[model samples]
Target: MEVIIATFFYARVSTVEQSLDHQVSQANDAGFEIDEVIADHGVSGVQHILKDRPEGKRLFDKLRHGDHLVVRWVDRLGRNYEDVTDVIRHFIRSGVTIHTVINKMTFDGVTTDPVQQAVRDALIGFLAATAQAQTEANKIAQRAGIEAAKRNPKKYPGRKPSFDRLKTELVRNLINKGLGTSAVAKEVGLTRQAVLRIRDDPQGVEAALQRWDM
Candidate 1:
């Protein structure tokens, strides 16, 4: 049998400006020799399912029996409680040892002690449920705010876009010239997805640009 020992790192951030390097460095400092890292940037854990995201789905396909999956924290694995438990359980059942760099937590299926197993399972379940519930509450509040905004569009001021007019024009020009999103981000010094979003919705970009001046 292949010694199937590997450490997989998962890093996630809710915004394009957040750095994955901080999480990577933390894991490395904790003495885990990470073989590969999978990240989903500018993606919300509470709203997006692990299996639904492009990078998140890619990670699901890479894990195998005997592989070790590591994360900065339990929250890194999921946005909600149910998702955290579901993903962890799915991998644990497949013989993957889930490790968290913070507090050096480990969850695996090999525990033989009934009491310890029960305690661990209970904690996992409780935490998962809490996370999911919190996520739902956030979603509800967000929906209410959005509905209110729709009712009075002038009352809700959205997030300000960080880029300047020069960057915006360059980003759009790059796409119009047939450049890929990644390339545009590289040239304009913005995240790849941000460039794509700006290209797709010029009106939104214009709105954001207006905020930059204020």
Candidate 2:
């Protein structure tokens, strides 16, 4: 009897329009024939763990022995060191292999040499730590920028709303219909925070849209 292995690609993006085409393109460039692609759109990696995410939960359930999991980077797997390493270790222990497209890094449980295994583990830890640190740094920078903007609102009006007229109308209608923020967000394919922004001050959002002539 013979066995066949499957390769799966996973990705997470913060915005709806940010497609996984780049990651898929990278895999193709690397000569990997992906059997499946699991993606979570409009999801924040900083807030959700693999199992907690919509499509991410499927990865744990679907991946099996001899399966290969491909990701663009360690950060895509998670936002912090603990979560990143935990997910990777879980997959490896389950007889699945992990490969990163960026650096061409590979992690598997098939190695027998103690020293080689130690080196691999160390590298994983280092990369995961670095990714976590980067996430924290980005958050800090964003906060600082917001504070600066507060000091001068004219100079920084903040980012424009993501929703257009149609989506905005849809969100407003959902809110008017007495739907909860979470339900409205799910229905409109938006984040809860985005829904809250509109719910908190529909007037303000409208004013901004009018001001910007959007």
Candidate 3:
């Protein structure tokens, strides 16, 4: 194992809307001894790669040889597969190690063997592609729900909840993405009970949103 000179944790979060609660703690819990915590607040990983984010740019410039970059997932590096692969490759070439906390995936730029290199590169490609696919699928689901909600908006007759259409959309989308009630609720800033209500009666919630012109 190569000696790590430093470890940095980076994440992109819409902190104004959501919370940035566990990113650094998660990395530490994953056994990465972080020397610094760098977060690109109000940035969407789905919309911008690490190079475009303010703090992300700093991260790229600050990393040095024998340094390790720890993230919750490989998706934090870029917005799409191409960008993700490119960024990972660039850092690896610069002798920086990239590791994901989820699977404990590590791409340390220390290997000379062709087989080890191939395996690591392939894993990076696969994870990046998977993250992109998930993002696309969530968008598709949200769009479909919106279109459906627009078709017949006359089912609701009660008071509207505190969540607006955007929050409702996020709730439904995350639920469709297979996130549990607590996760979806926490993500969209809704109560678990409210998320459960939306999950059990998506059409009702959509109709309520329409009623309020949300």
Candidate 4:
């Protein structure tokens, strides 16, 4: 008898109206043959662990050796950095491969190469840490915005942000790494002027990111 490997896409829907088919489509476009899509509606990924939600618990128990788990992002696996990391490690130990749509990142659960393992671990740690920081920063920004609104009820919404939260963070990270404006712009698919502005006024850029929740 042969073991049949299956690919599962997990989605955490924050609202009942949210359609996760696009996420499944995204995974398919990224070359994943999804065998199933496990979702938990109205469940906050930031508040619930994988095994805590009804469908989440099923997802955890359904995966097995040689299986693949696809997620829009690692943040879907749990509540924070530690939880996400733990969930990911547990899956790996169970021989379930993990893949994220963004950047087409993958963490092989059964790789034996030491260097590959090191890279996988480092990337997982960095991405999980980044997710945690982003969540905390979002809360702080929301609080500040509320306070500002209370003080000035007539303040208009600032100009719509061009770059998203992830893009802005990426720009900042590249700039911090000493990359030139042209290089950063090319790397992030932004215009030279935009990259130059980000390089010149990082603080204001960060403020825009928070203001627009981008």
Candidate 5:
């Protein structure tokens, strides 16, 4: 009997307007016959773990033996080194084959030779650590930028709002309809934190928009 393996594509984005479909397109361009596309939109990989996220949880539950998991990179799996490695190892042990589109890396649990296994495990660790380090560097740069903006609000003025006027009004209307932050965020294609900001200070956001003529 031949074992039929299913192919899955996993993708995520941290904010609205970020291209979640690009990863799927990349996988398609690579010629993988994707059975399903599991996506977590408007969710930050840096702040949410795979098990904790809504769509991430679905991916974990749906993956099975002989399944192929494709991601744009390892960072889509988790936020830090340990989390990334642990998730990959868990799936590999369950007989899942992991592939990356960016680096063309593959990880599997079929090796019996100690030397080859050790080499593969070491490479996974190194790549995961590198992704974690990049996340940290980005956070540091963001903080520095925020501090600089605070020093001169007239010069920096912070980042423009991710949502336009129509979406901003939709967010407020959702809140007025008693929708929770997470629900509003999911509905409006914004992050939960962004929705909370809008809920907590509607006037402030409106004032900023007016000042910027947005």
Candidate 6:
């Protein structure tokens, strides 16, 4: 008999003092043999989507049918409600099972019972929808904070951009030189869609440059 193997993947945003080691340790303690881990440093869950993120895009290529994906939480999947649902549905259709470590919740699509399948799907949808709503609330809070900073420019100091100015310049240069968004992004260490947005909006590039003190 062939061994039916399921894979687990961990993702995390690298902080100054925290690393993927913590997440890895947690997974190991949970008895999961981690097949791979894709991480992005200085990346915000609120700012990027699954396929749009650097490490997240790799998931599409790496995950196989019958494979299980484990996340720390639904928030790790996305920052928006719709985006998270869309991503989960995509994986479900692709025959990938999703498991959340925080809640120990699992969503699988292989059930034969129609009613049971419907119930499972409905639950999955509910969780994904809730994740999206929370993400939107976070966005609202972020926007409110930005507006507050504008209201009290002296008292509310804005944050510094995580990416480097030189990197942004490189992304712009590569894009202007007729490289594809994905190509330029790979060349300059950014998301493909981010490079596309910069290419499409010169003002956006300007703002990003300013944010990075370029």
lDDT of 4 by residue, 1-214 (tens): 9999999999988875767987788888989988889988888878888888989999777998989999988877865988888889889989888899888787876778889888888888989998888889989999998888757634634666667768777888998999988899999998888887777887888777766666
TM-scores for candidates 1 onward, in order: 0.62, 0.72, 0.68, 0.67, 0.71, 0.61
Query: All models: lDDT?
Result: 0.82, 0.88, 0.83, 0.84, 0.87, 0.75
Number of the top-ranking candidate, with TM-score as the measure: 2
Poorly placed runs, candidate 5 (over 4 Å)? 1-3, 156-214
Cα lDDT of model 3 by residue, 1-214, tens digit: 7654888888877647645557777777878888888888888887787888889999878899888888888877765999999999999999898888998988877889999989989988898899899889989998887777667555333566878878877888998899989988888888998988887887888767778787
Candidate 6: residue 171 lDDT (0-100): 76
Which runs of model 1 end up more than 4 angstroms from their true locations? Answer: 133-214
- Looking at model 5, the pairs that clash are none
Residue 80 C-alpha lDDT in model 6: 71
What is the descending TM-score order? 2, 5, 3, 4, 1, 6
TM-score (C-alpha, index-matched) for candidate 5: 0.71
Q: CA lDDT of 154 in candidate 5?
A: 66
Ranking by lDDT: 2, 5, 4, 3, 1, 6
Task: Residues 24-55, candidate 6: write the lDDT tens digits.
Answer: 77767777777877776667777787788888
Candidates 1 and 4 compared: the better one by TM-score is: 4
TM-score of candidate 4 relative to the true fold: 0.67
Position 115, candidate 6: lDDT? 97
Locate the minimum summed-lDDT window of 10 residues in model 6: 153-162
lDDT of 6 at 199: 62
Lowest lDDT sum, 10 consecutive residues, model 5, at: 153-162
